[model samples]
Target: MAPKAAVLVPCLLSLLLPFSSLALTQDICVANLLLPDTPSGYPCKPKPAVTADDFHSMALAQAGPTLAPFNTGLATATVKQFPGVNGLGLAATRVDVHVGGVVPLHSHPEGSELLFVFKGSMTAGFISAESNEVYVKEVREGELFVFPQGLLHFQYNTGNETAVGFAAYSSDNPGLQITDYALFGNTLTAEDAREQGHLRRKIGGDEAQGLLRIAEILKLIKVFFGLSAVPPDGRQDYRCSLLWTCGV
Candidate 1:
């Protein structure tokens, strides 16, 4: 009977091992933003020190400045600003677009996005990387559209009035890269840019036309960043040739 009892005790302990381990494991990892970020995410804040405020945020309640050429305001709330979302695969953005405004072509390298239009209408689209095919649609109020991860996408206010929307991202800190900014807003010199454009033109045909389009877009980006001025005739007037020269 003693041998049987000992065996039963060991089996019961083994069965409870996983439960005990889970109990000790952390269920939430509120971010410690002061610490440097890691590959996985930010380090967890002290659990005892965490409060309900850590999980709540109003960062996306207001619209950001729409001073750029796109006339789009973006209020982003990610793990960096909302510490409670740390280790949680979620982030959000409030988008406000004026009439004739656009979000411009951009990509989220780390996450896909779901954009829901709650006011007015927007024309949203994404370009496929493989085929370069465009998938576009007019999304109105109460409708939603999706953009796949790592694909270039844009939102334009095609409606008569101003448009507003909210975008939810799959990543806690989805990285954003606007195509025009990547091409023109960098610290590269104009000479370097012209050289790159020349090389792309050497490919000929549509590639050459694409390079031309990039050149035209460069002026708009430069103006948005205050690196250039817009003449009364609406032509691009360059004040500086090099981005680094302007101490940007």
Candidate 2:
């Protein structure tokens, strides 16, 4: 990666470092991300211009959403309020489904969804009516699919053209809580999962099994995102169990 040449600011680093060093390290430091509100969209700061660097730390838009690997387009709203997202009530995002594509089944144990199809034909639905656990369905565009909290759902491409969709969720980090992921590809081993079915946690030392499972998820996430391990002192759960760190 090339070194950034800096975003032509009017202030001297020597002078502002004492007063604005906080902007570089603090989350919710609105010195930058929250662009000045204006009548026509956001007004650019007239001086002390902001660059992609300003939002890079907390937003995925730094990379301009997915161009590949996603097999379709992806954009996130968590990236918008991230520096201040902690404890916030909601988050939103958009994902485009390509022709002959499918969104693998998943659930948000902590959130629900309201997806609106904006273009092309698509089939989207989620588990509804707890009694039989049926998924309510919607076909064609300009329609909606609402998944009650904790229900599994999926969307499939059904049109000749690419399908565009918007997904709104209730949590900041709504990961792929697919049954397979939680049961197999996660931070819990088969033994650990077995214990979960009982009323109490099994008390015993199977250190190797526990370590192996956590390592599996952590290592995979690290390789996927090209990250080093989370720092030891205050890290929790997975590298992305979510965070709100400050002054630690």
Candidate 3:
């Protein structure tokens, strides 16, 4: 009888082990990332198969290339190339801006962005025409800043050494709208782009183009903010939609 009992106990333990493991992973989430092993890279595997090892890389500690301001913040490991960012819409990595390197004035319309300083100093800000204010702020190592979505913003390296930092965006596919890139490249009118007390200072006139795109983007954004309606006459009444709306 004792020998029979020992064999039965082993079988029972095996049966229960699978159940315990399943219960542990019932509601956990994971991002699948593809890490590059060469000068170029490959793609991500399935998300469920990803280990924590794929999500964290210490490559930012390596010596940087001579690409100057834009080259240092190498995003070769970003969400676009890695599948971990697919559904979450959040991705980040490090940056190294040489002294006097400027990230220039830009905004990410799809989401808010923050830069965490690993080393060095810089200035950052956002300009809101509707709010009629510039939200410029300075930051150094161990500091951070948040730029609200759709606001025009910029960052400049102020450190004697190369400025290094971690940049995180709220979206995996964040749209980078540089103030200067928008105004001059497009066919938008300056008269149509003017704000209450502001005419764009030319970043090749892309600032004007950047501001022009805001009207429609902000309108959609307004809807999510609980604004009742976007008036038909191109005006911002902010009134609750009465009777009906083009929105419905």
Candidate 4:
């Protein structure tokens, strides 16, 4: 009986160890956005402090403004805005684009995006980093599209009416890097911008052309920030220049 008890206790300990480990890994971690974000995400909020409201957002139900030059609007729900999503490995955005508007060239460095179109029609595409090849499609209402991680991509309203899309990200805080802003709108020197961005040869050393490109890029930025509108004749040019600047 003594030997049998010893064996039973050891076996029980081994079985319980695995269950404890699983329990530790399965706990949900809500975000504490008041603190600085870490590489993974914000530290978890205390379990006792969490409530139903942490998981809900009324902002998503309202439409964003579309009066800018691009006539585009975007509302994002990330771990910071929706703390319940912290450590959940997911986030989302609502995009609205009037006719001729575009969600400009940008990339998510840490996450992939899945888009579901719900209103009107649009042309969506992503450019491959390895080959600079573009995969484009005309996406209509109820259609879905996936943009892989770290690729530059965009959506443009092609139908006569407004277009709306919902995008889900694979990470709680997917970082966005807009190409034009990163390259031209910031502190990067013109020489460095040309070399790293491969812009010099394309402009053929024409100072006026370079300035024109910068002006156009600024317009796109204004459109994105809802500060300006895309001129009717310039919409197609805007689309072409954006793709070209990225060497896509």
Candidate 5:
């Protein structure tokens, strides 16, 4: 009888474990931004201190200031700015592009993005990672587009006036890397770039054309960041060499 009772007790405990776990689950975990974040997300605010205001934010209500070269502004509502989205796996950004402006090549490593146009029009595109083929479309007011995770993409204002769009991400804190800034805005030495260039050519080919485009991009980055511009003589090798050595 004792042996039979022990086995039955174990079975009953196993059956009740799920209910105990569910009882421990939380309804919401509004972020406690004052604390350091973890791999999963910011720690939850104390229930006593959490409030309705934590879930509401005006961070994206107004157009952020535009900057030169890109003539673009961004207002983001991520966990850091909005506190309520931590561990929620969602965030938003407002993009405003003036006439003739562009949001340059960039990628979000952590999340897929969806853009909804609310005003004016813009041309948007993302490069296919598997085939390297470019896919583009002109999105106007009330239209939308999706960019898959970690793909290089861009948006350009194609209309006569300002273009405004709201972008949402599948992550509470979508990581961002602008291609030009990642490449030319760093402290990497010219030798490091040269070594990496060899591998790039072996994989993609057309090293010469790639170098030309790189030089042009470097010049634009330098000018945009208020650094000295590359010489206008346009000698590809000379321009690239000087720009690299000067750490542009």
Candidate 6:
């Protein structure tokens, strides 16, 4: 009788686990784009206001322009662009890189990224935070690679043809922090930029000095053009010259 009681209790708990999980995830919170966003996500739209259009976007089906310099184009579908994914904790980007092009060094502060390659080939890598070691691989079509959260990573198109890939992030708004732009294109003081952005550790002394000079020049350019120091999306614009010169 005692053995039967133990078996029955274990079986009952196992049966209830799925129901408990389902209950937690059963309801979907569609995003209300007009409302102010909170730390967790945007406020949920009223159920009556929600429509099927909230769940789709034609933007992801088209390819972005791949021009000179970096020769890489990225089309992102985030909560801001696709409100349907609001509070869903997931978003995606379509990346197209021409031969000899690179996605550059960048990090996502809020999410991990999983890259799925569907065309051509590329070399992708990320720096490990625990060991500070670089983990790199040559990935081809039908392969996938992962860049862990908050780690600096990059992808380069190594093949002669174009490379196409999709990156899925763990957050609806995965903040993109490009290494060069963060170091040289923001409102930070030169000293603060160097210290906080780790510019000294990443580049040569001459290069760092050049970047500082360029940053100063860009500040003047912004003032001359009457552009806001920070854009509505909270990211400072990278100067056209900087983008062309750095190939980022």
- TM-score of every prediction relative to native: 0.72, 0.46, 0.50, 0.69, 0.72, 0.68
Off by over 4 Å in 3: 1-73, 185-248
Q: Per-residue lDDT of 1-248 in model 6, one digit per residue for the tens? A: 99999999999988866534211343766777788877767777788887888888876697787633466888889888888887667899999988777887899999999999989988999999899999999999999999999999988875889999999999888989986566544676545544633566475455666666665665654543334365445544343333234333
Give model 3's TM-score versus the native structure: 0.50
After superposing candidate 1 on the true structure, give the runs of residues whose Cα lies further than 4 Å from its correct spot: 1-25, 193-226, 229-248
| lDDT string, candidate 3, 27-106, tens digits | 32333333542111123355567676655655445644543223234443455554444435466756676665666566
Model 2 lDDT-worst window of ten: 239-248
Task: Summarize candidate 1's per-residue lDDT along 1-248 as a digit string, tens digits.
Answer: 99999999999988865534111246888888889887677878888899999999998878877846566888888998898887677899999998877887889998999999989999999999999999999999999999999999988875679899999999899899987678667876555556777887776555655565666667666775556676446754332233212222
Better of 4 and 6 by lDDT: 6
lDDT of 2 by residue, 95-123 (tens): 67776555655787767878888778677
Query: What digit string (tens of lDDT, one per residue) describes model 5 on residues 52-86?
Result: 99999999899988865567898999989988888
Q: Give the runs in model 4 whose Cα sits over 4 Å from its true position.
A: 1-26, 189-248
Ranking by TM-score: 1, 5, 4, 6, 3, 2
Best of the two (1, 3) by lDDT: 1
Per-structure clash totals for the candidates? 0, 0, 8, 4, 0, 0
For model 2 the TM-score comes to 0.46
Residue 126 in model 3: shift from native, Å?
Answer: 1.3
What local lDDT score does residue 86 receive in model 1, on the 0 to 100 scale?
79
Q: Candidate 6: TM-score? A: 0.68
lDDT of each: 0.79, 0.53, 0.56, 0.74, 0.79, 0.76
Query: In model 6, what is the error at residue 234, expressed in angstroms?
Result: 32
Which stretches of model 2 miss by more than 4 angstroms? 1-70, 79-81, 84-86, 187-248
Residues 1-248, model 4: lDDT tens digits: 99999999999888866434211354667778788877555777778998889888865676677634356888889887888787677899899987777787889997999999988888999999999999999998999999999999988876789889999999877889977667545664444534633464565555655655666566556454433465555553333333333212
